[model samples]
Target: MTSGIHHFTGITADVQANVDFYAGFLGFRLVKQTGGYADAEQLHLIYGDGLGSPGSLLTFLVWEAAGRGRTGIGQVSELGLAVAPGSMGDWLTRALTVGIPHEGPSREFGEPVLRLKDPDGLIVKLVGAEMATPAPLNGAPTRLRGVTLLTDRASETAGFVSRFGYTNSGNTGMTQRMISDTDILDIREVSGFVPSVAGAGVPDHVAFRARDVDAVRSMRLSLEGHGPTEVHDRKYFLSLYVRDPVGILMEYATDGPGMTVDEAPGELGRTLFLPPHEADRAEDLRAMLPQFALPGEERFPVRELPFVHRFNRPKEPDGTTLVLLHGTGGNEADLMPIARRIAPRSSLLGVRGRATEEGTNRWFCRLDATTFDRADIRSEAEAFAAFVEGAVTGYGLSADRLVFLGYSNGANFLAAFIQLHPGLVRRATLLRGMQALENPPAADLSDTDVLVISGRNDPYARDGTELADALRARGARVDFRALLTGHELTGTDVTEASEWITRTLSLN
Candidate 1:
């Protein structure tokens, strides 16, 4: 049977940044700096209380160039670590000294938690708890207090956890707390939030401790009906993974063949360690990895929404800049031609969506064909807005002359952003778009000029009209046109949109 949490695995944008925050700031020991078992090019790092103990371990798979993740339902929202009682003040002091932003030494479920975000935006909570012994390092966490899984399917997840020997400890508000002898799992029930996207700063998987390979195989058998399972030899430990009903990645791992298998106890984490399979290519892999260095006490400026983008300089440098956003499954260059056709003289900046769904890029997550993730929409909007601000400064473009060109999912994101930010975008051309939020933030769009084009037979056509009306009610100058078509972009739609862009730019 599975016991407590073995370790929580996450994805990070930078390995050195992760080490600086987890080991340098939090005082956790850097137990292992290794390459991923499956991918040799990716760096895998382990941080723990001491000697990389099972319950104390927190691992990260680092990719330096990956975008930020979307945190919502079907994901582990927060990771909790056990700390000695009365250590919250020390942790807060360390956080301030290290230039880490944190919130709350607040009480939750009878425990004090000092919450902070890691470099990649993963939630880390140091909870005050009665520990058996003091940690080796000052302010280092004792052990894993388990993870909080955010899901709409709370009952299903609770039932699934029960099969792994966890018992329901009842609810605190809308959260369901489950517990075993060594682990505490919190299931937060969320509704109308977007499904999670796997990216940098997201918890990749939560692992439960198993006795051995036999126990792992047996657990896999029990998880047959619940979800699909795949067993893999991780060299250090045997692992079995499954996606729960709500889509959170769960794993069962053995705690044998520990960190000392390759490096000696005294020399642990002093040098880069590679698995046997990857050892042959160590030289090549090392050359490809970014330089690892502990950041100084000064805070690093982390880009909120780093995107793959292309910036095109206009033939005549007009003060007006056209920002192009693509729909689902489209890349940064996907909307370039349309943007060029509509505003040839305007500077063109095309951005790719950060979130992915089954390898397809999407601006935000969706619950169903008709339902969108409201929380993710807001998060992506804020990030996108930040990205635009950065672009404006980088390109020496005026914010007042900015115009947004978005289609379908991209258009929906613009609608959400304009509602949240009000006058950030002076003008926008939304193609086949609809409202993303049921109760959008009330803002004054009186100075905004918007052109909304909708397909008559599109499923969200009504939503498109409603959004236009909503904007108009907020005093925006909205020109809405409905064409006799479906969800796809039409030639007539483009022609009309081009005309609208020309007229809007002229008036401005």
Candidate 2:
């Protein structure tokens, strides 16, 4: 029977940073990039050895713009990677050069270990050990050494783990060591510890190896009274999940139908693959998911701009650019999918807001639920103007062909900008917008064209007409529409927005 860890999965908010650390810095090969098995909307990435070996695999569930999580009891708080013995100096030097947060060269459990924190603050311990196929001193980890589980009910968990072929080796302090055929398991018991909160940086589950379908079935049968999950066919493997006595998630996965089953070994991770069921929505999903450039590819450097921004250039460009500004609590990539559908051939530049309200992102400060901060609005608009000017020059984008698209709070900001700075924007679209200024000086907006869309059922729907009136009074061409909907966006918005853009841009 197969033993040891098949893989470990974790949650990460920043996919680019995660890939940079694991694949670029640590030298792991990106084995697969696919949509999540359970949710096709989010992405799932796998990193492993050169051959995409199961024992060396580490997978991640991408939750963009998610809040940070707490690592506490009932979680795998630390992931152990086996490295060649006496490689601490090399590892430390690499970490310093790459700006990876690290601690230790400290000895733990009679082995030299170097602790490095990933961008999301997940603990990765590189333990110096002599492996069967010894990894180079400055190379990718040979395989997973083990994982450190934080459990309050350690004795029960230990007994549960033994069914997967692990045997109690020894104990040091409150930590009991369990040895498997290919790796180690360290259960550190701490009473009265806080339970873990699920979000970014938390290890979701630890999967153990099963020889085949029969082995997985046998294991599932053994877990009858332990609340075992129904078997899930994950394309690459058949797996089942269960929560141990301490509430830590564990899985049993078949080793065959491996990583190379779908894609060739040489072409693995080169293309984004969706689950068979979601293949029909592949185009939409591609636009929604965050775009990333692997290491050594020609990529845009995220510069020190006035606003946090992200750029997505299509494979083929039609010489137009869309400047996207998201609503409150949203990030730079929030409106990517909508914008993509509106103008598939246009380049997208999504910018994050500088102001924050109640720990959530916003274009400008809010005095109250309905009141606006005038001074903050003016200041941010000026800064936003500067950011746009810089982006036009730096990104080699045409200033004359730029189109601004904003939603809600972002829409308000754009409306304010059009009033505060005349003729700055050539074309714009506002969704659920309002008149940002109480009273504004009339500016020459004859060179601009604006579209104002509002939901009739929305509380703020009346304000949309006010914004359209303000733009019209300033000599801008304004098209106003009220859809029969609520504050939340609907398919009607996409249809209207896309048709309007196609007509305005004359894109056949």
Candidate 3:
């Protein structure tokens, strides 16, 4: 009911590392370290400018356990921050001066926001706002103005947000309204809900505006991140956010002189935020964060998983249940970005391989090229079957509603699964993974809709065109494409796959 960006959350294995990553590298100030509402031994970390504005705060649950919590169905998608609109190009120049991997200074639906994922996969959005109030807290040069959450029940969340005077805006029935005395809070609820598995990308919490330390403390009385809340004086703005009902982390932010006090607005994101404690040694902090801007936006919004943010989260959308598997060394969290982008209309259940390959994630055992032990395949296939059966039964989906999406090593096992269980998957999306299975599976893909995307320059493909021809000869209703890419995935490449998937179904 209160205004501001607050109540953002997520789970993590290491709290300090997470904190360092945010406060130090990302330029967020450490405003508080509170007791965990769900777990006491577990700590809650709040990082943001001290202004105490909505969307300026962020909350976290640093679990004592080694296992990571899955970001899925019952979670917020991302924390959208309103930044200098049209200044995305300007932000890009500054973000590059510092070292950060940016995905876009691009558009989401329509809003121009920068998209960056935190160390643990939580998305943080930064967009341009027309009427940002003068910040109150002064901890970081930058401050929080507002926050947006992508949810399965946008209407329900908006119902809660509207309690504070927010209204619905956007062409897609999104909720928008002026939250503060003037700041606008935009919330959109669409059919864009994608169900993710335990390890998939998802939001755990979010925080809102914390006008002052007392208000932050008052908020701490009712919020989890406030238990051991730390007070900061960043000489810019002070802020914080704690955990919420759904466990997604949040933050409270504020803005007065803003990040531009030192540099111009054109240079806002070009530099990093240094906390008061680290301010004297700001140069040292600046040297620590990654030095490459991975080519996208300048100051953008932090989205949940791209898939969760881009597509609708559905228990069952269009009667199909899309199962996604990740590659080795990576968990289920990594692939959902591509999964959500490639198929915004399908319901997704992205999976992480059960077996850990020493340090990396893999579908099955692989000693080297062309060498896979049957023991690994058999066990993984069995696990795959069990996983498939459980998902289908749990979600009440039939074979016709089941789809397969696997990357490199993921496809290795999936191809094996298709060989082992002939009619399980109704459609298959195999990207950069078809090679490991040189020969066709024993089963026929006639009834199944298959989209095999290969990169022309990939060494793994041997020859991409030949691979496409081979699949067509196998009697599969296949739509094969060879893009001018390597094994690496790109947004342009993803768009091609998305178009193919749409056409695949439309033809049917």
Q: Show model 3 residue runs off by greater than 4 Å.
A: 1-59, 62-65, 68-319, 437-441, 464-474
Model 1 C-alpha lDDT per residue in residues 1-508, reported as the tens digit of each score = 5588889999997766788888777778887887778786677888876677777889998866588989989988899988887878988898888777799999988999999999998989898886542235566777888799999989998988776678998899989999887879999999889988889988988888888989988888887777578998886788898888888888888988777777787777777776677766665454334445553533323343467565555437677778888899986656766676676677677788988889998999988877888889888888877887787776667877788999988888888889998778889999988888889767899889999999888875545788899888888999999888888887787698789878887785
Candidate 1 residue pairs in clash (backbone atoms < 3 Å): none
- TM-score ranking from best candidate downward: 2, 1, 3
| Clashes (candidate 1) | 0
lDDT of each: 0.80, 0.87, 0.54
Model 2 C-alpha lDDT per residue in residues 443-503, reported as the tens digit of each score: 9998888989998888765557888988999899899989988788888888888788777
Off by over 4 Å in 1: 133-135, 294-508
Query: Model 2 misses residue 299 by how many Å?
Result: 1.1
Give the least accurate 10-residue stretch of model 1, judged by summed lDDT: 295-304
Candidate 3: tens digits of C-alpha lDDT, residues 239-351: 55443333233445444334446555333334434444444544322322212121232322222221211112432457555677777776544565466656655665666
**Model 2 error, position 84 (Å):** 2.0
